[model samples]
Target: MTDPVDRDSRVPALVRLTVDLSALRYNYRRVASVGERTAAVVKANAYGLGAARVVETLRREGCRDFFVATLSEGVLLRAVDREATIFVLSGPVDEESAFAMVRHALTPVLNDATQLQWWRAHRETPAAVHVDTGMHRLGFDYRSFSASIFEGFNVGLVLSHLACADDPPHPMNERQVARFESIRSLFPDAVGSLANSAGALSGMASGMTRAGIALYGGNPFVTRPNPMATVAVLESRVIALRTVAAGEPIGYAATYTTAQETRVAVLGVGYADGFPRGATRDARVAYGASRLPVVGRVSMDLLHVDASTVGREIALGDWVEIFGHTIGIDEAAAWSGTISYELLTRLGGRVARCYTGS
Candidate 1:
């Protein structure tokens, strides 16, 4: 019936997210090995792992092309890398954004007719052209797109998003490739591209594949093993210990009850720290090879884990591995009913990012 002790500063922050720069660099090389050239997709703050550090690492490793989802992201990357090429996937919709792109020396990936005309008229340097093969999200439709649309413009590359490259055998893969091939032929002077992380991993992406999820070591192929290095380690601290009586209800809404006299270790991470809010039985924290299974419902600020398996070896301020070298991101994401990209990107800002092995 005593209050839980706070172990702030002793553990050097409640949560520590370690990013392996060496692994990231290796992933870049692996992706580039498939395509002659590679464009690093660093959108969403490098999938919420800090784009500045990621960009600097890639730049040092000989990466020249970078892709971001917005003009602001492009500007942020431009500050980090002075000489590398920055491509804005989400092109400017207004005249001011186009001016910002020119001023920042960011290349816009023109998708629609409006973006096309704006870049055609205002772009001082070169810009990429996106033709819609099948994604139907961005890019111009190839059937209606004519050659005269890009006359006299400096088109650096023609790119398209694959609808089903992860499935490899999906008919959309061949269809998109064929369609993208025909579309890029009209602009023979421009470099052709039609792949993402999955495409790059499977060797389906041709001519300058843009890699996103795979860079952080997330498995791009569904049926095969993950070949990339472990680039990140998410961790939390054991704050309080309590003994729960058998059949005692635990956490919010009393979702779980202790099956026996159990030892519980409260961890300092929850929904606010990007751990799901309702991960009761499905979530588990790893301590070396042993798994500390989650016993109660997760909350906004904390989660409860059964430590009876560890006996008394676990103590206050001890670190618990959420996902790292031992636990794959895809495995953790699956337990949380989500994907690796969503899990990685949704990590809250409060967690401290510690880069290593640069």
Candidate 2:
């Protein structure tokens, strides 16, 4: 008997995720151009696009600073680029993690007093301080903030997160900037970073911008047109085709009934592949310029698309793009009732990631 894994590798993948490294580099330059300096946020495995490749691609484009959400992520990234400054956003929860940060040369973003204490006790290298401006998610509270708390610490960076950076007109952006500025002044010698993806795009970044989703081609602004290039293209193969008569229900739960004769194409991708099941509502897949509406419920391993409009143009084994240059990721994410961040990060492991334009 042959090995199942080897046999599977011999065949073509049903689902393909093509990452455009050139486009990713383009996006980094575009975002970095808006601020004094920018750091790449490669957390969540670079938003499920693969961190190792994204880090290498960005490093070639002159990016030296990187950020991750956890100590393990920082360690993994440190292994990729030994010299790049990697900041752990979640900070150290205990003495062992702090020691690991020092061993890996990973800087911890001290979030609270306890984390600060941990870093101070195991202090071997400089650490960043995250001052809570308004997000209230992480970091030290700016309301009762005092520079004395970090009196003898070698604070390399002081940063804050913007809650409403996506909405340029939101007042919170202004308030956060003002508060962050006050706190940043305390660590005058340290680098000040107040911008995330949206903030950096909108020119709200201070000394150093932490670019996250925008680096992967996600739109930073909420209402404005996306200025970044498309970096990831998700495609799936058509495995089967069928014709449904009028009044015939299609797929599980019998949600969609054909009013007229319809041509259906079964795609080899489903919710299990990170194509959200909720996207069954007003979702679509594209073949060139033709858009095919997704009907009925999305299964764990399969989905049905109404391909009648294309007639016989689409055939078995034909590749249909789930989202890419033709169909924007943001638009497809909206159909799933989620954001691009969630959609990108939720990509299942079975999908083969192919890199191009390196």
Give the winner by lDDT: 2
Worst 10 residues of 1 by lDDT: 1-10
What is the clash count for each candidate, in the order shown? 0, 0
As a TM-score, model 2 comes out at: 0.96
Output the TM-score of candidate 1: 0.95
The parts of candidate 2 lying over 4 Å away from their true place are 1-10
Q: List model 1 lDDT by residue over 209-285, tens digit each.
A: 89988899898877778888889899999999999999998898998899999999999998998997745466788
lDDT of 1: 0.84
Clash pairs, candidate 2, are none
Whose TM-score is greatest here? Answer: 2
lDDT of 2 at 186: 86
